[model samples]
Target: MLSNDWAIEARGLVKRFDGFTAVDGVDLSVPQGAIYGILGPNGAGKTTTLRMLQGIIDPDSGVRRILGADRPHDVAHRIGYLPEERGLYPTMKTYEAIAFMGALRGLPLAEGRRRGKAMMEEHGLSYAIDRQIRQLSKGMAQQVQILGTLVHNPDLVIFDEPFSGLDALNQGKLEKMIRALAAGGTTVIFSTHVIAHAERLCDEVAIIAGGRVPFAGPVDVARDRIPAQVRLETRHADGPWRAALPPDARHEGALWSFPLPDTGVEPLLRALIEGEAGILSLSIERAGLHDAFVAIAGEAAARALGQPTQEEAA
Candidate 1:
């Protein structure tokens, strides 16, 4: 049984297509009023797991509870789901489309339209409310669909690759909207292959690799799996302080970069000063979600996914 404090709970979820397994014994727990993310590469079974949670597809074996209900339909009206594939009636007016989606989720047509108009006004899309979906720009169309998903004011919202196909400006807007949703006590779960998005927006995250989840926890905890690093630059490269440098230190130009030793930076600073090394600069770089994902999911899997590394993103 799932606790009332949890918005979503899944146990031992397994899904197979023919002889190939898409998800293998996955478990997930999303707390109420939290923004959770599922991070994975393409074909990493992220969509499969989300589909099972929404009851769009059944797991071959497992139990899932949404809003404390064992059956999805029992709480269908409370969930707002934006699928990976965007589906909107191209000929329908933006406001009409939003109201129609809300109607499907059990909202009355009149109430749906009223809420849809309000949402458009709030999102600065009131000017485009009567425009046909096909007439809107890609970003506008995407935003319209998202507003539709929220028209009924669902308590739990799930977005699959919401950042995909969006420009940087639109991506920033979506991120703000997601944060606002969580702040308003909605449990927001999103799946993204982009580590940076997950790092910036998620309170907790689950990393999926090759149909299995190897790490699931707070974003800071994930980042802690990798060590912190320090980059030092000095005029004297071959001084007595060299002995104090870590074995993995690498020289690039005048800078020496290496992981910060567990013993701490104070000892290294003392050694450098004692050796009279002219310290030009010393900076510590903390490991981020991208580093954690690469460390936990393995470099090979990360490479195969072709997602940008943290350094590259930076």
Candidate 2:
């Protein structure tokens, strides 16, 4: 049975295509009003899993519940989805496009139009209000589609690669919009190959790789899996305190870098000062989600993430 506190829940979900496993057994739990991120590299079955969750495609096996409904159809009108592929009616005016999108979700055309124009004004897109979608820039067009997705003010919103193809400025705009949504008590779920975005916005996340989830919990928990690192720069390379440093400690000139000492940094700091090593700088850094992903998902997945996307390559 699904819990009332959860907006989404899935268990042992599996999906296969043409004898190839696209998504292996997967599990997820999303709180009622959180910004949850599905983090993974390309070809990691993110889209497939999302499709199954949306009831766009049935899983080969397993079960899921969306907004307390076993059948997503019962609450389809209450959810908004922005697919990886973007499209809109090019001939329609910007506000009309947004209104049309809302209409599809049960808003009246007149009410949708009124709300759409108000939204455009609020977002500084009022100048494009009367302009046709085809006349807008690619980024502007995408913004229209994004506005359309939220025009109905759905309780749950799913965005697949929402940041993909957006320039840095526009990407920031989208991030602000997502934050506003969460502040308004909406549940926002998004998938991205970039871990940084998830680290910044998500309250909780599920790290997926090779179609399976290896870790799912608070962002801090994911990062805390690896010990904090220490960067030490000292005048003297050799000292009695050197014994406190790990064998794998990296040295370049006067700077040294390694994981924090098992006995803790205080003992080492005390020894370094007493042993007469002139400390120039010392800083400890906890592992970030990017580092956690590499540690949890492995280097092969990291390579896939580092590869430039088509937009970047262009």
Task: Note the residue pairs that clash in candidate 2.
Answer: none
Backbone clashes in candidate 1 total 0
lDDT assessment of candidate 2: 0.90
- For model 2, residues 1-314, the per-residue Cα lDDT tens digits are 55656899999899999998989999999998899999888889899998898899999998999999889888888999999999998899999999999998899999999999999999999888999999999888988899999999999999999998889999999999999999999999999987778989999999898999998889999998888999999988897878778899989999998898778989989988988888999999998888888888877777787834323432
What TM-score would each prediction reach against the true structure? 0.95, 0.95
Which segments of candidate 1 are over 4 A away from where they belong? 308-314
Model 1 over residues 1-314: C-alpha lDDT tens digits?
A: 55666899988899999989999999889999999999988999999999999899999998989998999888999999999999999999998999999998999989888888899999888999889999998889999999999999999999999998889988999999999999999999999988888888999999998889998889999998988989999988687888889888988978888999898999999999998778999998999888888889987667766866555654
Q: In angstroms, give how far residue 286 of model 2 lies from its true place.
A: 1.1
Candidate 2 residue runs with Cα over 4 Å from true position: 307-314
